[model samples]
Target: MAPLSHYLVLSGILFTIGVMGVLVRRNAIVVFMSIEIMLNAVNISLIAFDRYLGQHDGQIFSFMVMAVAAAEVSVGLAIVIAMFRNKPTINLDEFNLMKW
Candidate 1:
């Protein structure tokens, strides 16, 4: 079994990676997945904190984040689908629909 600190460290690393992906990736889908990764990483940290502090606040926050993530995924995927139908590409650079 891993120690609590180990989980926390791993979660932090994952969160960093997700942030980097969001910053570096030009593909909208990749950015969306990176956001999801960040959210999951947060959940991991929240669970670890919940365990360490002997409280349910982190767990409750995790649930709330999960709900928001679900809605975000739905809306994000819908936009991606719509964009692909119009432009046939998912690259952010190729999206000039809203650009001047």
Candidate 2:
């Protein structure tokens, strides 16, 4: 079996890639995917640490994160769909963050 350090390193790499993707990508869908990747990376790290520590807290936290991610996906997809209809584009620049 691979060592816990290996898992941690892999998780870190995955998270770094995800952060870079979010920073460089303009499309909402791509950004959403990057967010998911980040979440999954955290999940992997949690599981690895949980196993190493011989405790279940990390696993539980990871499960909660997965639930939250699912809810986010559902609501996020709906919002993106609505935004697409209104703006006819998924570009981040088109979104109005300050408007009431």
Candidate 3:
């Protein structure tokens, strides 16, 4: 079996990559994907710790997070579609619908 430290390191790497994607990407869709990646990273860590400690709480929490992520994706996609209808682009810099 793989060590818990190894799992934690992988999770940390995934989270860092997600953060970089969110920070460096300019497209709204890409940024949204990055956010999802970050969420998955957290889930990975949660599962890893749950396995290491032989507890069900972390697994349960991860499921809750996944549900929340799903809802976020649904609402976020709807907003993105609406924004695209108003504007012709999905570029984050071009979204000024709320700007004064």
Estimate the Cα RMSD of every predicted model relative to the unseen true structure: 1.9, 2.0, 1.5
Global lDDT scores for all candidate models: 0.92, 0.96, 0.93
Ranking by lDDT: 2, 3, 1
Decide which is better by lDDT, 1 or 3: 3
lDDT tens digits, residues 17-93, model 1? Answer: 99999999998989999999999999999999898888999999999999999999999999899878878888888
- The local lDDT score (0 to 100) that residue 92 gets in candidate 2 is 92
- lDDT per residue (tens digit) for residues 1-100 in model 3: 8999998999999999999999999999999999999999999999999999999999999999999999999999999999888887988887565977
Candidates ranked by TM-score: 3, 2, 1
- Candidate 1 matches the true fold with a TM-score of 0.88
Model 2 is weakest, by summed lDDT over 10 consecutive residues, at: 91-100
Candidate 1: list runs displaced more than 4 Å: 1-3, 97-100
Clash totals, every prediction: 0, 0, 0
On lDDT, the candidate that comes out on top is: 2
User: Model 3 segments beyond 4 Å from truth?
Assistant: 96-100
Winner by TM-score between candidate 2 and candidate 1: 2
Q: What's the TM-score of every candidate structure?
A: 0.88, 0.91, 0.94
